[model samples]
Target: MDLFTSARKEDIARGAPLAARMRPRTLEEFVGQGHILGKGKLLRRA
Candidate 1:
């Protein structure tokens, strides 16, 4: 919520592994898991 907190998060993300940095942060950004991510599926229901 403060400047340092946000800056630290950015720095950590910058240093993270490529996969970690590229991972989807939201369901809308996810793909290729239709069996579990489809409408009415358990993941969305949660």
Candidate 2:
């Protein structure tokens, strides 16, 4: 009925990737980005 509930239903219907669906919902929930997504890290090293 509300935007939040509708969006969640859409996400469920689309069957988004497990990683994407389970991604950190907030910056505080994020983990160990220092290894992959941190500033000037491996992902950005290329």
Candidate 3:
């Protein structure tokens, strides 16, 4: 099978890892409590 299918199968077999569970699915969906990942703050500062 292709990489996408294989990865999905592995994900199903192993379930989501701790780090995977903590990943932000999208930019808007990210749970940003700290100012580090806040809206364009760091990027603007850089």
Instruction: Identify the candidate with maximal TM-score.
Output: 1
Candidate 2 lDDT over residue span 1-46, tens digit each: 9999999999785797878877787544668676776667766666
lDDT of 1 by residue, 1-46 (tens): 9999999999998999999989899887888898898899989999
Backbone clash numbers for all candidates listed: 0, 0, 0
For model 2, the stretches where C-alpha displacement exceeds 4 angstroms are 2-14, 33-46
Which structure is stronger by lDDT: 2 or 3? Answer: 2
lDDT of 3 by residue, 2-45 (tens): 99999999877578687877777755565654476566776435
Q: What is the C-alpha RMSD of each candidate to the true structure, in Å?
A: 2.4, 5.6, 4.5
Candidate with best lDDT: 1
In angstroms, give how far residue 45 of model 2 lies from its true place: 24
Alpha carbon lDDT of residue 18, candidate 2?
A: 78
- Candidate 1: clashing pairs of residues: none
lDDT of 2 at 3: 100
lDDT of model 1, residue 25: 92
Q: What is residue 12's positional error in candidate 3, in angstroms?
A: 1.0
Q: Rank the candidates by lDDT, best first.
A: 1, 2, 3
Give per-model TM-scores. Answer: 0.55, 0.36, 0.32
lDDT of each: 0.91, 0.75, 0.69
